[model samples]
Target: MPPQLVLASGGGWGAAPKMENGQPVPGEFVVPNGVPVGSVAYFQVGNPNPSYVITTVTWDGGTDIKGYMSGTPTSAPAKKQEVLTGVAKNQTSYTFVVKAEAKNYTVRADVQYANGAKGWVTVEFASVRPTTTLAVPEDKVGFQATGDTNTHNVAGLVQAIFFQATATTHQHGGSFIFMQLVKSARVESAYFENNKLVKEYIENDRSIPNGEDFDGKLHDDFLNRLAYLHIYDGNIMYGWHLMPGRSMPVPAAPPGGTPDPPMMFDDPKSQVPLDWIGNAFTSSFSTYLMYKPQSGVWVALNQIDWSVSQAATRTGPGGTWEALTLPAPTQVSQPSTPNGMAAFPTWVNFTSNFINDQLNPWRPLD
Candidate 1:
């Protein structure tokens, strides 16, 4: 007699049955249709007839199986036989596809059964996202020159005292003011001729041919005008002498050593008379003034009055040692000279002309 075929629930094939006449009966076998990446599947089959003893069960394709059973069919519902169990390979969602050809697979119960039955399984896959970050650079600081108090003397001259600046940190733009004290002298009195005889002697002397010898008030007015104009600018200050070469440890004379005073020339033949002259006396002092538009504040940095002398001089009355207070910015337009000399401001023309010619070439260093 021919053996009967049985089928399993999961995925498995039953034993091959004998041929009744010329055709062999079909048996149960389970196969996988499709499967997703990173997953497993199983199949099984069972036998019903008790007369037949299953010897072997095989699948068409070489698929991996977990477990199997082979024995004579004693029970009505005999244990199911497993054909194959397979595990799908790892792949991305876009790479996974369904095809007719048998690829990777898995099975659970492996055995031959008396009854014909079959089954299959499938799975799916997905894709992942990527990771990332960002970075930036740092910022820098800046600096510039603003003002000084000693450039008036160099007015109209080719090389004169100038306001110099350097960029210590960054780049910027603005203007600076340089101030100075220029000392000029005139004949005050050659010989004290107040009496009749003295006046007659002075009149007879051709060298003393002058009207109003020299007035102390005139000299006072000249110095006072210079001082007042500087103070009014708010960008300048008073200094006794010009600082030469911007030199360090400025030369000084010994105490009370009869330091050489500035020379005075009184040649009657010369067109310009009463020249107060001396290279040692020619010097400039410097102080810095800065205006910050953002903060609206005018800052005064280091202020130094450079002078050259054998020794420090005393602050005597009616001397250049006197300090003058600066006028308010509002009062700068029209300034009044304390001592009476020329009613007009002389230093203004001096500074304006100097800036136009000599100091125009002055630029900040890198």
Candidate 2:
């Protein structure tokens, strides 16, 4: 009978090569295709026969990996892969590096017993290429994150770029007063396995104080807004960054806080609405102030009427529409209402009466 084969190398994960369909075949290992071009995968095989010699190891997809970059490998590798004719079977293995065009591959090693018997072992591994629709460089294959709530998710497919990403503006509508206003925020983006975010990505991005998001936007105007969840001292904190290393005005509880409820940005409340996304339109309301707070309300109300008359007209799908109730402003502005927007609430207290009653109410996903 052939001797047993054992694996003892790092960077490899798979069942030992076994008899499949009555032939020696290596077990399969799955790896993301979105990996660094030169990333190395290592594997070793142990021979049960103490008196045997490994003859050869061959990698099919590695003909050009040897000296493609940085010149040739300096000395013989500690692990034997090629030219193993006289090498002891116990102390040898094979290693291969990823290339730009890598794909499914297998390695085979030939061995000979002291008594002139011949046998062989085979191992296999696979590469799961990135989604070509959102292709990213292989080297950028690490956990990445981006989003705040007023914007979109930031991501990269080509660079380890250090670009500015900001959300720091709260003009009128939205209730993220404390969440906006991040200046000089730098973010790096890379592809992770899938949308399934893990603690590794969270903690890694948080430590750097910079990162990117889904659409590949890495500029100072990076505006992907996502309800953020963080990890601190082994606790998951649900909240957003007002700036670098700070929390949003009204932060959320961490994981396990509500038994079985997933974070807002992750599950049921994942789809944030556009109308509910941006800050309120407060131009008319600001102009109302010129009429005095008491008159400001009336002036603002009237301005709506005037605007309704001149513009901002729309026809519903069912051929329905509503007329402007208040008069349009003659000199200044008014506060935003269900019909029109004029002013920005000085601050946002999402749970306060002002927000729930007067200011934009459809905000801060529950």
Q: Candidate 1: TM-score?
A: 0.17
Local accuracy by lDDT, each model = 0.21, 0.25
How close is every model to the real structure, measured as TM-score?
A: 0.17, 0.26
Candidate closest to the true structure, highest lDDT: 2
* Candidate 1 structure quality by residue, lDDT tens digits, 34-107: 23111112222333356434443343222232222111111111111122234332111111111112244322
Candidate 1 whole-model C-alpha lDDT, 0 to 1: 0.21
Residue-level error in angstroms, candidate 2, position 322: 54
Candidate 1 residue runs with Cα over 4 Å from true position: 1-163, 168-175, 180-286, 308-366
- On residues 1-366, what C-alpha lDDT tens digit does candidate 2 reach at each position? 243446523222344434558774443322322222223445464456567654443323332232111111122111111211122223356554433233555555555566676665555545322111111123322212223231221111111111111122121111111111111111111122345321111100121212212111111111222212323334554322232222222234785342322111111011112222111111111111101010011111111111101111113212212222212222211212211122111111111111112222222211
Clashes of each: 48, 46
Best candidate per TM-score, number?
A: 2
